[model samples]
Target chain A: MVFGADRECEFLSAPRPSTQETFSGQPLACLEVLGRTMVERTVQQFFQADVEFVTLLAPVALSHSLPSFRERNRALKVKLANDMPLAIGRTLNEYSRNGIDNCFVVSGNLYAETDLLDFFFFHREAMRPVSRAVDHDGPLDMWVVDTAKAMRFDGDQFSKDVNSYLIGGYVRRLDHPADLRGLINDALVGRCAMRPSGREAKPGIWIDSGAGIDRRARIVSPAYIGRGSRVHEDALITRSSSIERNCRIDCGTVIEDSSILANTSVGIWLDLRHAIACGDKLFSLAHGVAVEISDPSLLQPMANVVHAAPARGNLEVIEIEEENLFPLSTQEEAPARPKWQLGANLIQG
Target chain B: MRESSPVIVMEVPTILNDVEGQAFLQETQPLLEGGRPCLVLDCSHLQRVDSAGIEVLLHCMEDAMKRDGDVKLAAVSPACAALLELMRVDRVFEIFQTAQEAVQSFHTPAAIDAPVTLPWYSHPGGLDALKAAS
Candidate 1:
């Protein structure tokens, strides 16, 4: 009996004016994408789907001031209250008074694409509590309740104008800042689908299924490599790029169109175009400015440890400052010319 | 200030403030601090810029290079030249393509006209000169 969805959920109960008072007035209680804390990447995608006994309905003043959300959900089970549909209806009425009949209502800023969690456990074992995973505009990002049809769902029968159901993650209650860029471009373009493989596979690419890549990492097809992302040796991931989840694009970072959102750690001669890095800030979406790179060897935070250090000590300090200043074969080299000069006088005659 | 006078436009809007960056640096800081050498910056109703509107165009290019004046950026809006080449400061400004050729490069006189000899020469076997002109 594994139940989830409670990474200390307050999931923005709209008072507005707070994403640090509309972007960086400074007091962020969490919502950082590529450096953890979108409620710790939705509790590390529910502990990489091994989801056993999780509860977390948060807000007893953020479960007593988040000590790494109380030491990684120590054998989970939290139920603080104060409205989140009455704390997820009193934690689904205490998991339906312990008789726990199917439940997995996810969304702590939803980001689970674990191969769409086996198509949400095969549409919750073929429509159990009338399952869901719908997207391509049919909303519903994960839902598998059968607490006897959620005790006939009367928490105001959830309706933010429901057109095709399953609404958690405060459905569009992401308040402002253009609803957090339309909830991160509608969860990277699968439009609320529980996990239709985190959409985007072209026009600004976003591949995520088992994520590998390194037939010599060039990856330039628009670019975004989420779910289990990796791209070692010769990395380049060009224009309008994204590279989220379990990231690591070392060996020559050039990630252009830039977003690098989930669990980032890109090093090696980094170029990062357009930019948004997220967690430890670094935003510059063409200079809207944010920069707080607190050095983890310059832009760290993939929970640290990413060792690839050695451009042979920066090419031996540029070949010992070019052999103490231009000692290239006793430097006299300005001779081999002839690039293009036949009939060259075009105007200054 | 007479580049055959007619190009000192200035609408500037795609949202930039600080009273529109101090009213576009007080109406182009006195014709770019008097040398008035070539100043367009129209930006067909801009759309956004802040860092005090790119520090008033880097303070009108440092008050037009301390008065020898030279701030020619015209009609730029691809989101204001991608926020000035992502703040690499668009290679320190000077990008003209109109505003009457940036006020005719301040009164056109750097060696007036001399290069236009083209009576005709497009024949790298242009279909054998269009089959000997059909």
Candidate 2:
């Protein structure tokens, strides 16, 4: 059996950018990839490796807010730090005080699938104060450090003489939107360990729970329809594209090699190719430009939809505004009526 | 030999939405009606464009082709150029840096098929160079 149970190893995750500002130059790690956040996946990795505890260092602004992804480890703690380096240094000093010899210090802004137990054992065998992960590209921010020696760590950067552990597994630096798309495509094609969290309806096609895909909707292979998403009639999703949670792909809209992020509603009969859409903002990957469409009919945030609530007593005749009855959205909240409700309304009207 | 029609340069509006697109189409309708019409849409003032605006551009191009004529774009802003590229309409029109160059293109038969030189940012190494400098 693996020798990680008795070991008092811990994990310290540095502060990561909030996914809400993803298009505004934040790291892609916090953004929901496939069905889970990278932080959740990283925590799960530590939990699976029998790591004792995992602590997440969050920025002061994002201290109160946590991502929606579920963490497998209940021992995961969130600590606020105005300064990352000072926080990391203080945390390392505290760990040393607690008799915790060494801990895994992983960067929050990356998704790496290196064997944690192997890395731990390698660090011990190397007899170095610090061991950093390096791949074919270059050195990563991932490290295993001696808690005492790393007490005075220079922010997140390691000294030039630190030991290097060559990682033979997958690692993705979430620096750019193109890297995000590349990671998604790589995960879908089985180049990495990160798999879509859902049932594979067919070969190369993943459909998450509660996804309402019309029978007429054509979902070509190697595409993902995330949780609670909807794909309307004649909508074509092809070429390694992903319609993330709570998004609505309208009728006859062809999405090829693109990502329709959570809670977005695309207009009908439009062709979205090589793009990433979040609400009304569409970023073209091919052209390297982002535009915000002002027309609600063309594209709008799903949460911006105003619902007609039922009125009590006296029965005041409130006029109901016309809603776009076009089929499907890709996420959770169906505030007023589902697509079937629209069909019922159509019949009644 | 017949003398060619003079190139008509139409100024595009600031915001190219449905209303602006219809007005633009109406303004260029007379030019498209003429035989062998050479049109250049100057987009220096363009800031925003919707899908309908792109549709108007296509409609003008179709009308021009029907009358044995052509439509070219000139002085397209980066934002407009990006949108056109997104809609895959960049390949349909011949784009020029300035309206004068677009106007001169009509008279120069040899320069009609010349490829437009791409901006530095369009090159793969260009982004790396930019990043290095920054």
Best by lDDT: 2
TM-score of each prediction? 0.29, 0.77
Candidate 1's displacement at residue A173, Å, is 9.5
Candidate 2 ranges beyond 4 A from true positions: A1-21, A24-26, A62-65, A156-159, A304-349, B1-3, B18-33, B55-68, B75-78, B85-134
RMSD of each: 24.8, 12.9
* Candidate with the greatest DockQ versus the true structure: 2
lDDT digits (tens) for residues A121-177 of candidate 2: 888889988998999999887888889888766854464568899998888987677
Put down candidate 1 lDDT per residue, A1-349, tens digits, no spaces: 2324421111222122244323332112244332233444455456666555565444443332221221234445434444556556556665667666555665443443434345445545565443544444455444556565565676445432222333333244333333444445555444653222344434445455445655555766544566556676676876536676667777666667666655667666556666656444456565455555443543555763221112221101111111221121122323222321112211111
Query: Model 1 over residues B28-101: C-alpha lDDT tens digits?
Result: 77676554445678766766665568778888778767755567677766545654554446778766655666
The local lDDT score (0 to 100) that residue A71 gets in candidate 1 is 23
Candidate 2 structure lDDT: 0.73
**Chain B: TM-scores of all predictions:** 0.27, 0.79
Model 1 achieves a DockQ score of 0.01
TM-score of chain A of each: 0.26, 0.81
